[model samples]
Target chain A: MAAKYELKLGAATREAFGKALVELGKENENVVVCDADLSKSTFTHLFGKEFPERFFSCGIAEANMVSIGAGLASSGKIAFVASFSAFVLNKGFEQLRVNVAYSGIPLKVVGTHSGISIGEDGPSQMSVEDLSLACSLAGFTVISPADEPSMFALVKQAAYHPGPVFIRAGRVKVPVIYGPDQKFVIGKGIQLTEGTDITLISTGLMVAECLRAAEMLEAEGLSVRVIDLHTVKPLDRELIGKAAAETGCIVVAEEHLVDSGLGVRVAQVVAETSPCVMEFHGVNDTYAESGLPEEVLVKYKMTGADVAVTARRAYGRKK
Target chain B: MTRTSDLSELQSIARTVRRDIIEMIGTAKSGHPGGSLSAVEILVTLYFDVMKHDPANPTWALRDRFILSKGHAAPVLYSVLAETGYTPKDQLNTLRRIGSIYQGHPDRRFIPALEASTGSLGVGLSLGLGMAEAARLDKSPSRTYVVLGDGEIQEGQIWEAAMYGGFHKVDNIVAILDNNRLQLDGWVKDIMGIEPLAEKWTAFGWHVIEVDGHDIVALQAAFAEAEATKGKPSILIAHTVKGKGVSFMENNPKYHGVAPTKEEVELALKEIG
Candidate 1:
């Protein structure tokens, strides 16, 4: 169970996104940013500070910002719009569906403060359903980068990707797993630890927790496979199917609701390829009260220990 | 600007497009005729006179973009697109038929010439603003025109786009309010009061110009003024009558979404002729 790799202190994905956006703007002049009066909170203010002319503060207008991003994407520039996940996905969902997704425009929709991690924001600000909302739309590439390294790389990838993209970013700063030289491709999952007993698939901040859970499980004489399923929509179905066939059981962990998030996507892949037992670790069909990120995770049963317990449950059900 | 000094030519094209709208909706048996008819002059003035567009190259980089934000009036947009050679004139009869390219609303997937696919109201202004912003970024000398319904503006998102467009000074965009006064339920005033409409636009940082929606010459002049009036987005509050041009349907909310009967279509065509 000893730590296999030294995990460094990392910044929030939103911070990584803001830094990456400024970097992208320096390289590509067509990279434009717009925010719905949340530039400071969403960290898009960094890009605004560096590229004043390229950034737009669309006031408290999420729908307008979304369509405006689509319009900019349609013409020539790659537009990246940011807002709180609750407002951007829920309030401006129709605009995202029609203007961006239906029209097939490459607009980067960055939703920060996703899940119940934005401590003290209450249920209203927590975007527990954004993953489902974005995945419901056809032709949308949804990604939830695990850490700062992946978030920066994916932000760059979304700019060149010629379709709509929805990126779920967290508010809490977590442990960094990947190095600066690490590369990532869209719709692909990276296996951090390889084993054959049970596959533990996690995304966003949960990937770091799954790494820790894998350590705990390996110490108990269990062969655990850990996968960073950052891309949730166009899920690495081939990898998931292989995991299901080889391991005979799987456990999915996400910071989102359990119903239509990563667990449902994994279930779909396993059902189609290798039918096996699966357990989900997430917000179990309930809203969380305002609290610290750690307390909320403990209350909602979303910690590394929770993931290990779910993996053990899946492991027990394996026939 | 191919502004025909011969007013009769523009008037003739408008009259023919109005007839096309009536016949198309009449054949469909389920479409909005009143709004379609009310917006005839605005559409004609933009496509035939004011806007710079090439029918041969619909996606021309410097071409002016028009968005029918009042999407229920698809008949008017379709007729104009057909007249501009974007769609074949014969395809006008297939207005809402299954397997036909023409739907009840303007969908860019079916009609490539359509600048944006809009059916749900109040979203087009934001889209047009986006295009205008893009044009500004690209330094492309193209303008974006958005036609909005009076009732559609009550959707709150319109005001959001208005504020953004105004604050950002999206001068490359011009929003035309088809202030036909009539909505599906009743008059826009009776349903939801939008009084002091001109002042609202001005306060939102727009150049407001009130004009007669049915007058082709006035519409052309207003559009010219909108293009010349730089530093802010311009809104032409086009005062129009519902079911404009037809005696039985004029200013009538009942015909907002109902198609014309066969006999009424004949009488309406005779009236336009």
Candidate 2:
């Protein structure tokens, strides 16, 4: 497999979110941030440092932070609240439902340290169901950016967006998949490579692994297409249908539970628009143990080789 | 300060609001009446006298904001809005019906004039604090008031906002507890006690003011003191009967959610008159 684009190690998506928040704060005076005592880890402290008055530290109260964000949004401010995905999405699910989603306020919520990638924290801190929880909410724009540049661009886009948004960020550094010059749009998937044999669709940190899997499949004389489906709530049905029709085989991957993550949504699109042989690669209905991120991902069958195996099975089943 | 003449006018408005609450719930056939009746004077005082708001310009940025955290009491809020000209008086009958702007719960989607769409308990205080912080950031004098229920404070999120408000010295925000002393299942104390309530607020760094929930004059003065106080938030522990105006419904948990019958509505309206 020959590498088509230069792959550089970038800071974690959480760090990119922090830098982007600082940039948003500098540009928009109405930008305000709320953090639930994990400011340092979530990197919201960076924005807090630049805009002290606009930043609200709501202690360890994620539920209160969510409603407070809704309040600020209702009062004509671009409000954002960040915490660990498990804590923010689970602890604040009711507030998110009633205050932000039901009230129709444009409150931006960022959940850092998502999925099993926040290694060594154990399953209690891991958020394998955050995407499911977020996507279920009506009027919420859910996003899971693959890398630093995409997260940076998508977060800025989320701020200008006029509705509630939920962005899933990660604790581990990932390979840069896009350049600074690349333009991003909400509810649109960015295709990283062109192919015809099969398509690799993924979001969040799994996008990089999908790219690696594509390379492995290409080396075996199979043409593979790779797409980054960032916005999960308003699922890019058109692009997904196109891939399913063109490639005849689709493998959906993510660092979440296969039962309810991006895979289920992609399958729904395939069933409705273009029926195709499909495979899902993710945490197969179980939680991972305390280990290094790479070890945990490999153990849970969420690595590139793992995806390649799943892709091969789907490809073999294709007519 | 409220003059005697103004006090009587406010009392008159409160009586009308109480009648409207009973009639609206009675027509709906299924709505909370006890809590709604308990909050009439509080909403009347804010909408009719205390808050600075224009009915025509409901979205006015500078107008004071009021959030009904104990949102099952929407009948009282809707009646108050109609009395203040925010909504048409005739529309009050459509409450809890399909395709009606007046939803069973307070939903701002149906009526944009509402500060927040609240029905679930324990989140409005935090929302009010957010509005207060926004006001501070904009350097606007617009204040935010949140009305909570005695039983609703049992939610942990209320204490979360309480701690934030007091520690941050959110002076522009005031929370009023409708101490109706009753909830759906039974008495709040029998279900889950929140006693030493004033000391609880004081420990949270709030300026606690106890008042008669039905007294328009005392409520006006308490709101003034809350406004004049600096470097802290305020909470008014307003003592009120669960169903104040109707003899049959007063202090009765059965009326907490069950609406009055048509005949009962007639008797209740006469009692309010």
Candidate 3:
């Protein structure tokens, strides 16, 4: 199982989103894209180039953009607002919470350059806590899909998902792991591997890492099940429960911090309803320093190999 | 004091709303009465005479949008909505209570007529602008009206929204500022003044009109003119007292967020009468 097939799907989250939006605009005339400036950085320039009339650039005004989205939403149009994750989620958070989520508008906030992966840009641009902020909203769906195929699939789904959604995307270029034909379903976990020893639950950028960890672990005689949960909010509870029942132990990993990440959702599901031994692999309460994605990930101990070590620990705690 | 039944009808309805706000706040044991009372005339005009909203069909897609940006004054909006049959009149008693749709803020999830959920200031204008832009795009005839507190405009986000609206030529949007000039802590002049307001809006490229807020005819004229104008968004800078009609409350900054005592309620209703 030596890194079998080198998972060839390759595209940055913003690039994948840009490509998918171009595809969506070709089909749906009502799908409008709004940006608070940062159009080039957010990759929304793709949509702007294709549908200039439909793409709105508000220019560094995130709060206004969010509210404008709510207004457009009331009129039966699917509005997608794009910006850097930090400003869009943090600066304009109250507007998103009230105008979009509370009003149940069909607004999709596309957060580009999520996580500390926007290396050398400094902490000002990093949006490590956006997942938690999005998840806190009652009806807001938080989607952090991994690779080009799932990113495209989720973007398509969000266009139809009735209510507000925040899609977190990283700037880093990683290997494409899924085939172009692979379908992504909201609130559904794709089982990358099946095992009885321990379940490895991961999402977003961390999904690829878990696959690598699973491959490395198989070499050490550990057959770990890996579940890629593309959507974090609605959370595939049925699959998580089934996996917890079958494996008796689980290791939850995310590129976000330990709290309110996908790990927290998984832990809540397992702890409250189904009892299982669980270990969380995430950035423990701390600011990430400037570094390459690989170097930063390795520093935070979130690689597939690091995840494999935690999976073993989880398996040992199982009955 | 002479008036037609139509004017008396609106005046009586406004009194009913004022009474309802006091009673509901008393029942909830907490709610803003000053701004609520101050907005009664505007809300009355919009609900009864102006906006084309059907209470029975709150989800009307092409229905004109209304956002109570100064959501603290939700008592007036909710009271009007309830009396108009948007919800059971009895539900007014549940304001701010647990599990009640009538929150301290107007939650759009609970109230359908509410176009946007707003408590945070300065956001309603942007929402209106967006809806107006969308309408322009869809060729929808529906218009969006957003009510802003004069105090709320101090938020940088509101200026950002104002600038964006002016830059985009979002014509179908109307921003109404309730320039009662009293905020939570004190008189807005003592807090952070926003004077020369009409000039400010005019500079921002809006078709600015300053109106006597309590004058029904002036309000009607301002709104009518806003609808008729084109190519630029409009702003109705309504110069109002901190509390209108209620003698004790008017011009008193202390009433900015105070719930009325039972005695005060009796006095307020009598004053309106």
Query: Which digits, one per residue and each the tens of the lDDT, describe model 3 over residues B70-95?
Result: 99999899988887888778888899
Candidate 1 — which residues are off by over 4 angstroms? A1-3, B1-5
Which regions of candidate 2 deviate over 4 angstroms? B1-5
Q: Per candidate, chain B TM-score?
A: 0.98, 0.98, 0.95
Separately for all candidates shown, the number of backbone clashes (residues 3 or more apart, or on different chains) is 0, 0, 2
Docking class of 2: high
- For A145-184, candidate 3 gives per-residue lDDT tens digits of 8887788889988999977899988888866878767878
Tens digit per residue, CA lDDT, model 1, B1-273: 244535788889889998999999999999999999999999988888888898889879999989999999999999888888888899899999997778989888888878788888889999999899989988899999999999999999999999998888899999999999999999888999897999999999999999999988888889999999999999999999899999999988889999999999999999999
Better of 1 and 2 by TM-score: 2
Error of 2 at B145 (Å): 0.5
lDDT of each residue in A1-319, candidate 1, tens digit only? 2267466779999999999999999999999999988888899999999999889889888998999888888887889999999999998899998888877778999999998888787899998888999999889999999899999999999989988999999888978999877779999999887899988999999888888888889889899888898898899989999999999989999988899798998999999999998998888887788998889888887788888988888888885
DockQ each candidate and list the results.
0.79, 0.91, 0.75
Give the runs in model 3 whose Cα sits over 4 Å from its true position: A1-5, A315-319, B1-16, B26-28, B83-85, B88-103
Better of 1 and 3 by TM-score: 1
Which candidate model has the greater TM-score, 2 or 3? 2
Query: What are the chain A TM-scores for all the models, listed individually?
Result: 0.98, 0.98, 0.96
